[model samples]
Target: MTLHTLNLTPHGLGERVMPLAPTLTLRNGQRWVAQHYLRYQHTVESVSALLAQIDFDAHTPLFAGQDEQGVYVQVGLIGRENYDRSNTLRVHKLVYGRKWRIDADTPTSEIIQTAFLAIKKAREHEVRELLTVRSRDGKTSAAFSNHHDLPLLAQQRDQLQAGNHRVATLDVAAAVQHQLASLRFAQRAIELVQVLELSAGRVLIDVQLGAAPLARQLEGDFPEFEQLALCVLLPAARLHELPYALMDALIEHSDRHVDETFRFRGFARFSRSNQIQAIADLSLQTRPYAHDLADVQFEQIFRANNYEVDASRAPALGEGELGRKNRQLINQYENLLGHLPRGYEQTHETKMA
Candidate 1:
C-alpha cells in the first residue's frame, strides 16, 4: 500500500499515524521489517514533507506516529530492518530542514565494534567452511589445495545435494578464485565504514542505548518481561566504567561457541525515576549450563573491575556503605520480580527451590 493510501488514525494531540506490519509491501514494491517496533513523533506538515523526500522506489516507510513534539515517521531501507544512520538523518533533515547529529560516545563505539565483530566472524566462518573439504574420491590431496579447489569443492557439494554425484569436476577454479578475491577486496574496502554507519543509526533505535524516545516508550510493552531475570543493576554513573567488552564477549561466546545456555539480552536504562540506573538483562535459565556460564562471565566482569566476588565481601547491615547499596539493590530486584505475572513468581520459586 502507498503512504497516501495508508489508513492513518489521529494519534495523540490530533496527529495522524499508523503501524505497519512486517513483510508488508508498499506502493514501490518494497517489503518492511523492523528489528524492534518504534514510534516517531512528528507534525502533519512535517510528515508530508518527509513523504515527499522519500524515494518509494528505494526506501520503505515502516510506520508513523505523532506526539507533542511533532509527527515521527519510521523509515527503513528496501530489504533491511536496520539501516545506515545517513538514511535516518536524510529523512530527519527532509522533514525539519536541519541536520541531526548523533554524538560519538562509548555506547555508540561499543555497538559499532560489536556489529563489526559479528560480521567479520561470520565471514571468516564461511571461509573456513570453504577451506575444509574432501575430493570426489573421498581422500585429502595436496592437488586439491589450490585456490580453485575451494569453490569447485563447494559446487561438488551442491551437485551431491542435487543427487548428481557423477558430474565431472570442471576447471572453473580460476573464475571462482577471482570472484572470491574481488569479494574480499570489496569487503575490506567498505565493511568498516558501512558497519559503523549502520550501527550508529542503530544506536538511535536500540533500546539498550537509551537514545531513542520511541524505543524507551515501547519498552513498557516488551513481551518478554515475564521471562526476564535481572542479573545486575549498576548506578548510571558507573556506566562508563562497566566491563562492556566482557559483556559482549560473553554474549558472543553464548551465541557462537556454546549451545543455548543463556543470552545476555540487552540493557535497560532507567533515568526518569529518583535515581538513574542501568539494568543488565541477563535472563538466565535454571539449567546447570546457564549457571556455569553466568558465574564465569560475572566473575570476569567483577575481577576486571576490582570488585569483590566472595560472599563475605558482601556488606552486612549497618556495617558499611557498600552493604546499604547491596541491600537496596536486593530490595529493588525483589520488588520488580514480585510485580511480574503470577506464574512467573511460581516458576522463579520452583527454580530457586
Candidate 2:
C-alpha cells in the first residue's frame, strides 16, 4: 500500500504535514512535493514491515524514533547490522538549538594563544635540562640553556661545548622537539578556533595558563598542566575524520546498493530529500526547525507528534568539542547532499522538461 493509505497510528508511523500553501513549482512545470519529516515508533519488526512496503528513494525523508523501552528501530538507510541502540541517525540533522555567544572577559582565542606559548616554554625547559651536566669530580657543574651558552661551558669537559658530541645530540633533539611542538600547536589552534566558531564562542577552555610555566618547567605551580597536555596531545584529525568517514560510508553504501529493491538507499539519498525540504521550509518560515525548538520544546513536539526525542542524546552547543564537531558534521553532510544528484531518471526528466 502507498504511504498515504497506510494506517499511520496503528503501524507506528508519525508525520508532520507540510502546509499546502507553501509549494514549489519548478521551471519545468512539475510541482515539487514538499518533503515530509516522518518519525516512526513501535518495535523493530513493525518498522521493518513498514520499510518493506514503502518504495524509498532519494526524495524520501524518514526518521525512526526510540521506542518506550529506549531501543531505537533501525532505519534501512544504514545497514541493519551497523545500526546501534543509540541515536546516531539523527545527529547529522539536528542543530545546537541555543545561542553560543562569546564571553567578554576571557575569549577562547586568547586562551589558546596562552596555552600554545606555555607548551613552547615547556619544551625549552626540557631542552635546558637535557643540556645541563655535572663533572665526574662532583666539584663543578656546567649548564647551558641555548647554543649561546655553549661558549661559557667550553672549558668544562663535562659540559656541552661547540663540536662536542653532546652538543650535536642536544641540537638534533632540540630541533626535532621544536618542529613537533610547532606542528602540534598549529593543529590544536585551528581545531580550538573551529570549536569556538561552531559554538558561537559559548564554549571556553576550562583552564588558562597565562604566563605561568608548565609542570615540566618545575619552577612554579602547575595547575594548568592537564589542559596544556590536552592541547598538545589531543588528536584534532580524529574530530573531523569520524564524520568524514561516516559521510563517505553513506555515499559508498548508496552507490553499491542503488539497485537493491529490498534495501533502502543510504543516508546520502535521505539527506538530499531533507535538504530540499529544508529549502522550502526556510522559504516559508523565518527560522529553521533547529532554532525554533529548544531542548525541552523539541522533546515536547516529538511527544506531541507521537515521536520521542532523547534528551540525553540531543547535543548541546555549550558542551564543548563534541558539540562543535556535531554542528560541523551536520553542515558538511548538508553541503554534500546539495551537490548530489536526485536520481538518474528524475534528473534527466527534469532537465528535458
Best-fitting candidate, measured by TM-score? 2
List where candidate 1 sits over 4 angstroms from the true fold: 1-62, 65-338, 346-353
Q: What CA RMSD would you report for each candidate?
A: 25.8, 24.8
RMSD of 1: 25.8
Per-residue lDDT of model 1, residues 160-250, tens digit only = 3432122112312232222222221101110111111122111110112112233322332212222222122223222221223223322
Question: Which pairs of residues collide in model 1?
Answer: 40-72, 41-70, 41-71, 41-72, 42-70, 42-71, 42-72, 43-70, 43-71
> Model 2, 153-202: lDDT tens per residue?
56675653223122232243243233222221101211121121123212
TM-score (all chains, Cα) for each model: 0.16, 0.20
